[model samples]
Target: MPARPPAATRRTAVGAALLGLVAVGGCDLDDLDPRSDPAPGSGEPSEPPADADADLVETVVTALSTALAATSAVPPRDRAALRPLARLHRRHLAELGADEPVEGGVASMTAAQVRSREERLQRRLADWSVQAESGELARVLASMSAAVAQQLALPAPRPRGAGGGS
Candidate 1:
């Protein structure tokens, strides 16, 4: 592995990255989405986001994959509610320039399982985002983490077209 940059250099890189992101007037996935014309992961290897610390990205990927694995444990009745979160994790993986993860075997997802996996993913994303060498990468990771938190805080989504009594 290449020697990590000195602290001063890393800090400079982080600052420059943030400045560049600010110059563009955006910081979320909208500006960072790479899935335009040719498609996001068109079998072509993508360059890691600006000075993204390889180790940090790897950690995020692991967390994401874990969350995806948890998806398989979702009970049949709950699959509809959890499906979107799984899809989002897949998108997050793609945004990180990572390959698609294999799905886990089917099993019943208990409330404890959902809470444990999702919260762990959120924790890892938040913690690693802070240590990211690239401000751009950090921002993206933080956003992903926030999305997880938002989803977990909300009531489980009802199946589409399932309405309550008038």
Candidate 2:
């Protein structure tokens, strides 16, 4: 029963939504065949390199969880939030497994361990986020995510055996 947005507003909204789609869905899903590496070229690599931001996020999530697990500050009270974040990482890793494999069986890692790690990492990140709005620790964390993205982009080693199995 509310009034509709003005035409300009509607157009702007649609454009924003489309832009979001391209940024989130378009950039990450482009396929890169394992056997065909890009020929050395100019003008900032092509549409999709091997790794995408999403892949990087997945790796960062793991590292973050690991860092979290090893942290000393997180109290028991804030621990519950980590479960959902860990689950998100697990789901993201599963999707990555279908497209690109992760080093070490992250899927096989216990949920409890992941939860513990995430809790610690969250506490640490929260602390760091507070201390320096923009600084070395933040930069380091950001850099780690980028590194993970780059690694994800590399073609996975070809599987062994006749059927590509070990």
Candidate 2 structure quality by residue, lDDT tens digits, 26-106: 322224232245446654455544432344445445655443342223334433434344344444344334333333423
* Best candidate (score: TM-score): 1
Q: What is the lDDT of residue 156 in candidate 1?
A: 70
Candidate 1: list runs displaced more than 4 Å: 1-52, 105-108, 157-166
Question: What is residue 67's positional error in candidate 2, in angstroms?
Answer: 5.5
Model 1, span 64-147: residue lDDT tens: 887887876766666767777888898889888789887774366775577677988888887887887666777787777766
Enumerate residue pairs that collide in model 2: 50-153, 51-153, 68-120, 68-121, 69-117
Model 2 CA lDDT for position 127: 46
> How many angstroms is residue 134 displaced in model 2 relative to the true structure, after the best TM-score fit?
26
How high is the lDDT of residue 135 in model 2?
38
